[model samples]
Target: MSLAEAPFVGNASARRVHGFAAGSTALLVGDPADGSHLAEAVAELGLVPQSVSGGSAGDVLARLAREAAALATSGAAVPLTVFAADLRVSAVALLDLVDRPSARTSVAIAGPHEIAKDPSAFTLIRVERTQRLVHSVGSARHVVSAPNALAVGALLVAPEDVPAAAQLWAAAADDPWVDPALDPFDLALVALVRGGVSVSSVPLGPYDVRRGAGVTVGAAGSPWQQRLYGASRGDDGFFSTFAVRPLSRRLTAFGLAHGWSPNVVTVTSLGLGVLAALLTATESRAAWVAAAVLLLSALVVDCVDGEIARFSRRFSALGAWLDAVGDRVKEYALLAAVAWVSVRRGEPAWLLATTAMALTTMRHLEDGAYMDRTATSRSHLVPDRLDLGPARDLGPADAPTSLPGAVSRRASAVSWAKRVAHMPIAERYLVLALGLLTGSTQVVLWAITLTVAGALVWSQGGRTVKALLGSDGYERDARRVDGRWSDLDHETDLGPLARGAGRIAPLPFTASVVGVGMVAVCAWFIDTGRLPRVAVVLAVLAALVVGAGCRPSIEHRLGWQVPAALWGAESLLVLGVAATLPGGGQWCAYAYLAAVAWHRYDVLYRLRDTGSPSASWVTAVTLGVDGRWVLLAFLVATGASMQSALAWAAVLLTLVYGAESAAHWRAWLGREGALRSEVARREAEV
Candidate 1:
């Protein structure tokens, strides 16, 4: 029988209380005679329970292989949480430990006494430090003698490793000394270790509830639920933790009880943020106070969406993208509104607002690029340099300094202080709200600029130095970065002539940077009307033509920085061009920048998730970077009608990029939902 049709004996209400999403699978492995209780426990934890009878080692291996294949074919991307029927553990504990799906393999670990109860059934593995590297797996007594011994009571097979697990088991079936009942867990542990998979250990001591005979959950008020809440409160800004979470967590719990999805909470938060921005533009004491309150309220709701996702293990890629983009939209909208109010009061605040927006965007681009590069290039088993202690050396004579020992303590205030240095969304939002409330637009704008500038220099500057001096393979990392940033498909956008010319004289990285720099300078001169229109048109055209053909071929070790440099240049060009216009023209420039920013961030998210950027047509319509520069030249040439030209450009860019991007992502989401539904349907059938 399929696991879904298996006999379940646990209290039916228990199934409703377990908050995991539908379609999870759990396997009960033990003698056929005693598997009923295990199946009952799995059912109680809201998973489809299947039983695998103990037999000869070869037979067990065959059965496991078949089950793994079935799960794989059924589109079960979530890992299979396998439990030993002999294990006397609380179902609540097991569910709490393994409900959150992860790519890494995790095993439920028990104390020596618990292992002693089923010594032959357990596989003891040695784990060192928090990294949880399993070096050896064997008989319980032999392996448990080592320090940090984790006795495996359960096994988790990540979907990607499902086939490997099946093959490893089939291969081990012929081992002469393999005990089917005792060594299946050992063989699985060995497979994970040999495959270089990091093993996470979920210790069961705190959650264990074997009081004499009957299983029981933790003390009154469900400690597991409390732990879930705590885990969901992840490391946010210090202000968020101290000021926002206490209320947000309660609201999250209320939402969870009422069956609210993360996406719903996200929409609510977005509305509040937008409303707050609109109110901020009213330019009055009452409106400012109301805006500040609403902004903070919006942040609280924002925290709820993420917390709900974590608490219920209902994460979605679309939800993540929306949350990230939502924050950017809210912050930018607030800045623009403040700038508008300042302008209404007869002040030139667009410059400061533009600086803040451009600086923030540059920081985000650099951060994302650096993170993507490092993650893709990482292939080692050692701790990252930032995680190591001072005694750990990265390389001779030029090693970067590690976090101090005090910072390693999980509960230390120093650790919290260290996180605060990152200046996360919570901190940034608080700064913006406070500045808006105080009625000093320039002061708040400068505060944000200086703070972000300082944080960027502190973070990226150190990382650049470390990347250069570390013993890790910097060349490989640089190549990955280059591929990520320079993988843009500009041929279609550049037209046939430009594409053909690119073959003969493609711009090198250094020349492209210089060319973009020249364009920015000339654009500024043109916008301010400091140069004759004919001279401006000629110089801009010359600068644009330098990169009008192809993308930069970056081969330098520091080519990753080239994108940020180009982005900075683009900001200068846009701001300078916008400055030439009068009243509403500035908002049009901001709108154009916003559209471009959305596309840029969309590219980053898509590249990170799918390993590809938006489609070629999208780039063509938006006018790829080279096309944009050429277009700017034309706009400069229309010196008398600059305002009308700029307005049309902004409107066209927004409509084309925004509409196409929304349509693209909507189609993607629809496909994803359909796949998920198919998987769930298959699970139900099984």
Candidate 2:
């Protein structure tokens, strides 16, 4: 007889010959070939195999228990044999079954048989204890019911077991299931049953398989599987992604060595900024140099603080908060220094200082309020518990106490507007240079000191106010109520408004031509003693104001508002020089001519904000745009103007401004071309 048609008599005959019970159950465990033989022996002894298949270890154990339960409920005899592919399957299912006392237990070994010169052998063996309790007439019927009943009954089981049972039924009911279509779990289940072993427990732990004679079973740990698991953790080194430079590294190291926390660095920078302001108040040239150095040092230290935090992994919410407070202090100090200089020089000081303070404060307040509102709105929309503070703050030390504090911290941490105002290198240097040039060094130094004092007050004042009010009082104050400035307006853009003033931008071609012509005509007329000085001043101011108003959009985009204000200042300065002219029309004529040339140059070269331009470029352009022509005109008109070294200093500024402007133009053009090329490439690809 062929192996398939051979009587399944090996384990079955042993049980029968030994007078064991036909329904006794036994668990089968051995090599696949040996297990097949045991299965055939069990079948020969008149027992049946029940099988279940699944993908995961958890799923497999669940399926095995479900199949075992089904078999027991089907009225199978007390002794049943369970065949498992590996120890892992058997262990998992055995533990599960032990937990559920209702599951029936059995063991059997199904081993391969050789017949008709082929290895398509199957064996089933029954336990030798219970065969006499069975009747011969009903044995065939029990065997026939095994496959069909298990398949149909599995459908009535719990939803979780349905998928595994369905897989088993599919394989048994069709030949295609045994082909390449069969998964590893399905194949193992089918092979166990065919080897005459009754499957009870699912495969759980590692399985070892030998592919050739004298070959050892492969180890349990698979490299590919381990990698897949490890990759899920998602860790990447910092340098690979951030590309931090050596200078940043050195700065970070320095800060760490000095025991300087980011917050401390931020505070120290503010202090230095105050020193720069004080320098501006001095008439001495040495004071200006000192102020410049201090400001530059502050900028460097400011950069180092952040780098240190990132490098040392010591970032904190409090540090960030202090940093922001320090930034405001520095800004106010610089501006105040300028005002002090103006005041000492007999200019209107209080008005300028107050205006600067109010504008800066309001802008920051608006920015903070807007961010808080936006975050609150988003939180309401998304149902997630988002902690928007520093990564460290989310831990036990700062577990959120109240909804408002949590929201406030998050809002403060992520407000982009606050960061934008102070971080750029160009901005810090600009403030430094402006402070040095506009006022005496002592004025600058005093401004810096005052700024630091103000910052300390603002920062500490809020907490003091909150403490006096108590928690309930603070909460009441924190409550939001509708007010003005909440509404968005089209004119909210800051850049273009600043640039519309000629002081922040290059003069338009028409303006340049007209300015040149008017200066020439005024100079010639003054030489003849026929020019009107007041008319010249009024006419020039009117032209500048009108010109500035015409290109509001461009000014807004470029952040030229300050430059525009400076233009108004220039006109006033020119008027002052003209009024002081000794020869009346003759000498005053030079002042008018100089004003036109200087204004034109200012419009063309004054540093305009190009949305985060490089520090080098900003500095270069700023220094290049000189007002020497205007100063020369002032000297010629006043007649009594000093020829001291200090007078020559003004002339030097003109040359610097010119050089900076030329360099900036070159860089801007290159950047523009690169951007255009990138756009073209993207379009082509599309």
Candidate 3:
């Protein structure tokens, strides 16, 4: 063996290893050292690694296999986790990775981009899970016909596979590369794959100490260092994804070393977040930009608070509860101020603003309540950042920070989910900043309204059905693995015609569209001058239908009772507001705007989910891709004077709309001898 491998190999016979204790999952620590940075991190998660040592990786495995079997339940595979003295990982993220469906020996490795600059890449070998092939962000570089190779760092092993691992480890140790030069991480990968183990990239961000430089527990000045410190698995927000995590982690890292607490960071974030709202709620142009910048800082600060909590081990149940409450308070203050600005502008978008806030609160509380009861502590709900005081305060001891992920946490057992449909938090704030910059209160209302409505429906609809009907809904909606095509996949070779036919059209949503449209059209012809009033009335009706359809149809599809009566009551309230308004005739257009706003947003969300076969490039020019822009274009055509909306309209129609209409209309009118275009294209998916 080479010099690097000598120490571990030489002491093989002298190392002591043990089997697991009763009711205890084995955490086997290898390669002990004086400073236990990683060992302490493992301890933070309440798993103190049973101290074990063996001469080689094989000896280590042999010991674990010999000892742990009797501790677990009969016929159950005992959990076995191996940690090196150097790796830093999120304990919760590690749990998710180990629990996820995988091979007998599942390994997680650092990505090429994640490690900064390490050339000793680990080849990734993932076993094909389905007949449908994938080629998106992760799969594009996949090596077809053979296991793809990429660098990785950690392994999550099932104890039963120890014999296989040991054999491979011995083979790797004998290789020329293993003695002096090979990375222990890469060796693990080699042994697993050579032993015929399938592999995938580490789902969580795990630190690999094999690299010459590592992120210190304390921050100094390296940009990459700061970003990594603040970052975690499953923060898929825009600013949080890119900006906030990086900047905030840098500050948090520094403060942590200098003796700062999570409570201090939380208080600072609360103050800054509230100040940002008050600033944006003003009429000054500069203040709008300032508000955006300050809001960005507040988010960054908000992020740091969590990092401090997690890193310092000072997290508390009460602190987590308060942090959530503060977030809602800040958002509410911001929304209330924005609503005030809208009324001042004489546009009356504050009506939509108030409606958005109420619904947003509902979505927030629902996610929080569900997560508190079921999952481990971590903010797992997308757009679930709002606060409601304790509904049922279950102690989820200071949730860990999750790395960037597909969605916050899994959204119930409901499958066929459009995972990337949630709005980016940074995009939401940027839109608000844009609206403020241009003094367009309507834009701000539109942004907030769609976000609130979509998230509320998406989070609550299925869960409510599950509670009402329990396991019956799951059985009814579950699809078997028969020979029928069922997904809205972009990577498959399915023809456009076949793809279109397979679209997931929820029948209840389709019915609601008809119900709302028929009602609107009949009201429109009642009086010539009252056309605008009719449009406004119709818009509110449509918003309710579209928003309702988001989750309502799922209930109907599964043969569950939908709260149609609740919807009927909401309709009455919509009419009551319309009739009671002092300036009903003047602000009526905004009502249509609100309805269409929710509908158009849902359309973009659904089209992407439905897997329309149109070229992605075509999506930019297509009206069905996003409806809010259509409303903006219409507002401009109707002489909206909010900061050159007319100019924007002129540009859209002259440069884009005519050609788009020709493209879409020609397809509808049988360019290929097909005539499927309906009279109204209001809810068209493609």
Candidate 4:
């Protein structure tokens, strides 16, 4: 029989069911006297509660196994969270810690005072510096004198681990180290450890627990709001932290008070950004000042959207995707506007503009590629994993007991310096604003290019070190360009010639550099009536770089970043060639490339999040990167009307990509149930 049809003997029922929007069930097994109150609180938090108080851990597990099996048929992945009656953990801490996307099977660590009050009632957990659990012990008395490990209580079993957890609980009774005095909470902790569960510990902080009362939620106080305001993303630059974010927090509060969704705020920001770009294109002093104001305002609102999402705890793939896309569109639109204003002033700002865009795109590509490639490796933040014997009190009183604590302390000291070196979006945008205020598009573009180039060198140097140092997940197979890679969509259009040429090199860095060199030479000679020859070289180079058939691989540590750089170089060449054309085709080129960049970014974000890029047909319609270069080379060489051709291409690309991207996101939102379920679940927890 199917799991849904299976019989369950457990005395489990939804004691208090909220809306189906918050349909997940929380299994409660704690002090029998506190069961009803706990159930009520949990229900109020939008979870269905099932109390199974006063049972051996094995007994509770047997029932859980049966019920969990039956519930599996429903297809909603609901975790089983076991709460300890005496643990006064707030919902904010619990959700933030346990509900993270990367979180594994986890247990809450009891505070020192709680462990001191009743040492026997908890399981001592010792972990390596990487926070990987190394040892755990529990009994009626102390397992080891003056244990150098944190005490573990409460357990959260992820959906996939529920069955294994049940089996482990049942087998715990047979273990020689099992203590008869252990309660369900302690027993479950021991069972999970002894069963070799890769458990992580969440240390309870002062804010996580109440002083005297039971569960004084931090979110209700002003201090919690302050904490949220200060919880900036690690990569946030100095200007963002000192100016944008502080202003954003007040706007975030206003947004929340007005019941505005994060997406609404994002749209508002996008509108402001578009307006700023339009004003910048006017090339007047008054317009420049207004544009700067609008751009800065847009940045502040951009921050507010994210802050609202974090503070309200309403998150979704759509919101994240929109925010990312909006940023790119705003930045690029403003960049093109800057170029337009410069050309009108009889200044040769095209080169500077293209250079700036290319550098910025390259930086973003590296950031995305390196981050995605090393995400798993960086999660632990350690070069080596230590698997030492049982932890003991071996050092002097002042010596540090936790290696992670020491690492964190050291890292905090250098974090500000590192952020300054990165020169993030806030700094880049500020530079543009400052240059505009000075009424010099050429100066601003040059400044942006130089700053970005320097930042890229710093950032890429660090990434190269990490990749070469044999970081976890930076192995050969992981770095290989495969179907998971979206940057080289042109490969599919190239056929076997491209494939063979790619295999000859197989290193993306080599291909990217060579392709870029070929394009640069083409751009240089295009104005000298060598367009046909340049187009031929471009075709051959494109074929070699985007070789199809074979699974081309980049053996180098920095291979994944090559595709992005190559793509940016291609865009630079396109813009450069258009600037030299007659009848002001540069604007048309910018519009075309902007549409093209949007599609590429769509492919990028989709691949990052969903493991699938845009459809192959879409690539064909847009002429892929290879096709676009060949066509542009042909048109310029044939003396065709460059303006009309570019304008049409821009219109066509915009319509196709815009429609397809919208359809895809709309479909994705529907499949995800518009994030209603997640919103409901997190609302109560936050």
Candidate 4 or 2, higher lDDT: 4
Give Cα distance to truth, residue 495, candidate 2, Å.
Answer: 34
The residue-by-residue lDDT of candidate 3 on 574-632, one tens digit each, is: 32333334332323323332332232222222233332323443333423211332233
In candidate 2, position 436 carries an lDDT of: 73
Q: Which residue segments of model 2 deviate by more than 4 Å?
A: 1-249, 383-429, 432-686
Residue lDDT tens for model 1, 521-549: 76677666776455355444434444442
Residue-wise lDDT of candidate 2 within 1-686, one digit each (tens)? Answer: 11232222112111112112234333332233333443453344333444433343234434444454555566643333344332222111121122121232222121121111211112111211111100000011112111100110000112233333344433333332233322223233333333233333211112122211211222223421221121111121222112223333445444555566667778888888888777766646678778777876676566666655543334343455455556656655665566555655655353334334443443333333233233333322211111111112112343332111123666655553333333233343544565575545344444433543353345334434544454212111122342211111111211222223444554542343354334444444333445345335433533343344333222111122223223333333333334443322222222232323332323222212232222333333332111322333344444444333223433543465445445655676687576546434433432
Q: Write model 4 residue lDDT over 250-286, tens digit each, in one string.
A: 7776666667778998999999999999999998889
RMSD of each: 7.8, 30.5, 20.5, 8.3
Error of 1 at 636 (Å): 2.5
User: What ranking emerges by TM-score with the best candidate at the front?
Assistant: 4, 1, 3, 2
List pairs with backbone clashes in candidate 4. Answer: 498-547, 499-547, 499-548
> Order of candidates by lDDT, top first?
1, 4, 3, 2
lDDT of each: 0.61, 0.35, 0.42, 0.61
Better of 1 and 3 by TM-score: 1
Give the Å shift of residue 290 in candidate 3: 5.9
